[model samples]
Target chain A: DVKVTQSSRYLVKRTGEKVFLECVQDMDHENMFWYRQDPGLGLRLIYFSYDVKMKEKGDIPEGYSVSREKKERFSLILESASTNQTSMYLCASSFEGYEQYFGPGTRLTVT
Target chain B: QQPVQSPQAVILREGEDAVINCSSSKALYSVHWYRQKHGEAPIFLMILLKGGEQKGHDKISASFNEKKQQSSLYLTASQLSYSGTYFCGTGVMEYGNKLVFGAGTILRVKS
Candidate 1:
């Protein structure tokens, strides 16, 4: 079975604080993605990595960066968290652009 | 661009049936469906490619219309466990491997 795990289920951070959300997949997929889901907004892509050290910006990448130093791990970084950045963060991995397997999301609260 | 979903929300009884539609303005290479239960990660339902194939899992099924760039999900004899937010992610050929997801449709099933 494919397993995707996130570093946290919930997190709280003060404004202007740095935040990191980690994801790891055991399927050895080549594609990994970061998305933020908000009510009535669905899942909007923040960033994606196709290979180690290879990153691409999705539709909404502002104030966010991603790292893919290894194949199994992907990390999302918020340069300086703001209240508007509060959202449910989801990490997904796919093999060869197929159906994605998602991790339990991290609900971030930026106060 | 994000796909458009019809009927923002729906409510059904345990034995009732419902349909959710997703349409995109751009030409789509594939359509992926997911169900996200409350406080859980989204789970892959199915993927419909450009060939306009119909796929099913248990009592749930989906069809894609390549000509119209549309897809529809059908849930028959719905069960309480079927309650969730349904999202359709569209893959555009020009967009490479990324999928643009629609604002999801919320489904609630009552016994």
Candidate 2:
């Protein structure tokens, strides 16, 4: 089975603090994505990388950046944590455009 | 653009059927379905491609309408384990493989 591992299951950060959320996929998938899920807002894409060292901004990419140093690893960084930025963060990888296997997700709270 | 989902939430009994719809303004190359249980990651259900394919796995099925630019997920005889939030992720051909998911529909199945 393919496994997508998230670095943290839960996180609490103070305002203005920098935060990092890590995601690693065991399968050699070429595409990785980062999304933030909010109540009623659904899952909004933040950033995605099609290949190593290649990244693209999604709908809501402000104050957020991504790093994909390796094909199996993708990271989401909050430049400065804010209350509005707190939500359930999910990571996903896919073989092509078909189905995406997601991580367990990290619930982050900013105060 | 993010696809719109109808019937934000639904409650059904075991063995009942339900339909979840996702419509997008832009043309879609593919539509992906995923179910996420409370406090868990979204699991891929099915994917519909541009050829207007209808995909199904087990009792869950989905159809993509290329002309309407919409997709619908059909859950027949839903089980207790089927209770969760269902999301549709749309991929436009011009956008590469990055997907924008719809506002999810929360389903509650009772015995």
lDDT (CA) per prediction: 0.93, 0.93
Question: Which ranges in model 1 have alpha carbons more than 4 Å from their true place?
Answer: B53-56
Write down the DockQ of candidate 2: 0.91
Model 2, span B1-111: residue lDDT tens:
889998899999999999999999998899999999998889989888998665647778888999999899999989999999999999999999989899999999999
User: Candidates' TM-scores?
Assistant: 0.97, 0.97
TM-score, cand. 2 vs. native: 0.97
Compute fnat per model: 0.82, 0.92
On the 0 to 100 scale, the lDDT of residue A95 in model 2 is 88
Residue B103 of candidate 2: its Cα lDDT? 90
